[model samples]
Target: MKLFKSIIYICLITISLCSVAMIYGETRQSQWIDKFIDSFELTNSNFKFYNIKANMMIEKDIDMNELQNICLLIAQNLTNNKDEVCLKTEKSQVYVNYNDKNTGISIVGIKKNAKESYIIVDILNNKVYKNIENIYTKLENELSEYSNDVDINVCIAGEYTKKLKKAKISDILQKILYNMYAEKISDIEEENFLSVNAYSKLLKENNLKYLDREINLNIGIRYSEDDDKTMIYIATPIIKIDY
Candidate 1:
């Protein structure tokens, strides 16, 4: 009877140990989930977005602590202000948002093993998608070759009309300056220096006798060094001839 009591005591002790182990496992899982949710909220509120979805998967045998760390790393790696987006993670799910038409959410998934991990992002309604796609098509047509060094997947997604206008203006100014240098004639008379003969000659050469509209020509010159070569910078303004 004492042996029987001893066996019962051992069984009860084993059961109590098993129950404690189960509770500890549950608590760990709950804590891991809670941490992911909290971190997601903290990170997601900064950006505007339409929608977001994330799926994170880890091997069943992976430690909860390790899983949490991996999730955090994924979040850190994918979130950025240039995208104008925010992300939220709840357990294995992620959510994202962008403020308006200029921005949109992206969903990223992570899968990991002891040897390696993979990250996949689904940029749904992402502003860069069409731009990147167009760039890729153009690149393919131009190069007929693929380069790993070039990131064709990246794009600038924004309203760039103003930027384009500035660029065009800069190009036109450059062309105008180039033309002026090519056409410049030396020995221009200064406005302050009155050369009676040269001034009369200039007016006569320009056919000012029958001019019906006002004509004004202002010219100036400066010097600079470019690529170890002396460069002459010239400015000229020409107006219509007047009687």
Candidate 2:
């Protein structure tokens, strides 16, 4: 099922961005992040944080000029930099870059086609920020002025350098899934990678179908040969970002 890399680009544009696939309410969105952090702690307390990403998709068409303006606004608001917000255009995407050292925020506006376009605001940080929820809520409210409907997807991820057997990784995955009260839908284990797709009622997030089965939680364990470290990622309503 290509669990590790399910998202693919077409025509130099991401036609099916994972951001639009996952759904969660603004009020309860933090539930998934909390659960993920809890799961990571439970499985291995030494798991160092990788990043926390939040994606917002505006479900309406926008012109390039307007998209650029929105991207700039988002960037300024995120980094509180009104001076000069760097924006770059590549193929069908316009990107806004932030210049913070500890926390990094990026906003991109993608033009899928003439009749369809969307803006994706992604907030990435190496360490967990206390005001992440507030930032998301504020951004959602600001974006609402442009489009009435906005879809939000969040993924909290971490990693650790420890070589463990497949059985041990499976046990960790099982503990995480069980803690979330998730029902396993499918799982794939390769020589160096293991992934599980499941659905958890406690998450309160929307689910997407995979191979005719409903799944809303995705857990992956991978062993890196170069660094010789194991990486584990947990996301509710399916992980939108590539591991």
| Residue 170, candidate 1: C-alpha displacement in angstroms | 36
The clash number for model 1 is 11
lDDT tens digits by residue: candidate 1, 11-129: 99999999999897656534433432232233222211111222223334444344444434433343345345565655543444434555443433332445333233333333332
| Candidate 1 wrong stretches, greater than 4 Å | 44-243
Task: For candidate 2, report its TM-score.
Answer: 0.72
Least accurate 10 contiguous residues by lDDT in model 2: 7-16
TM-score of each: 0.22, 0.72
With candidate 2 superimposed using the best TM-score fit, by how many Å does residue 27's alpha carbon deviate from the native?
A: 5.4
Name the runs in model 2 displaced over 4 angstroms. Answer: 1-27, 45-63, 81-84, 89-93, 111-115, 129-132
For model 2, how many clashes? 0
Root-mean-square deviation of candidate 1: 29.5
Candidate-wise lDDT, in order: 0.32, 0.69
